[model samples]
Target: ERLGEREGIASLPRPAGRLVWVHAASVGETMSALPVIRLLAGQGPVLLTTGTVTSARLAAERLPERAVHQFVPLDVPGWTRRFLDHWRPDAAVFLESEIWPNLLAACDARGIRRFLVNGRLSAASTRNWRRAPGTARTLLGGFAAIHAQS
Candidate 1:
């Protein structure tokens, strides 16, 4: 059977307890998250999501035991909804700065707790964020907390 032929996310062996949804923008973010993930998984399961194909592959190689890796769904409302519904994470953490409006809204609606780790507001991105304060504020407000890198 072709992958994704069915309606939802790929099946991985689900962990025994609570799951942490960690989103990484790329390889570096994935690597940086691994240690924290290990620490978190000591408490519960870890589900790692990455936007790029390469990052997914890297996570598959580097992810610790009890950590599952998968590609992140596009930020379209429908896809994000399906992805979240399937995974049903207890908490979420977005590495670096991936501010997907639809995804954040979905998380908010579902009442899934979320965090932004290693968040950096670069000078360029800060200026851009300022230009559209409403949109930026909406996205930023979704995070339960932000752990800035610097």
Candidate 2:
């Protein structure tokens, strides 16, 4: 059975208790999030979502027992909404800077707690964000907490 079959998402059983959703964009993000996933698993089931096939494979091999890996649905509103509705995550943790406006908006709309771990803002991106402070605030401000790494 394919782990990230989009159609299969609806059929996937919801975690029994609190569900924590973690978005790790690719291999590096997945690696960075492994320890965090383990920690979150101790509290509740963890849904680890990554954007690349390679990351998914790595996650399967390395994620802790209580963590289930999934391919992150596209940032499209409909797809994201379906994914979020089915998973109904209690809280969300994003690795690095994998920020998806639609996904974050959905989580914020639902009032799901959010955190950004090891976040990195490149100099160029910082300049762009600085140009549009309001947009940056609206998007980045949604996170309940941000842990940055130099």
- Give per-model TM-scores: 0.88, 0.90
Candidate 1 total steric clashes: 0
Off by over 4 Å in 1: 1-8
Expressed as tens digits, the lDDT of each residue in 1-150 for candidate 1 is 313412336556556678899988888898899899889878878998876778878987888888887778776777788788888899999988788888899999999999998998889889988899999888888789998886
lDDT of 2 by residue, 43-145 (tens): 8899998888899899979988888988888777887888888899999999888878888998999999999999999898899889989988998999999
Worst 10 residues of 1 by lDDT: 1-10
For candidate 2, report its TM-score.
0.90
Clashing pairs in 2: none
Supply candidate 2's per-residue lDDT for 84: 87
The parts of candidate 2 lying over 4 Å away from their true place are 1-11
* Best-fitting candidate, scored by TM-score: 2
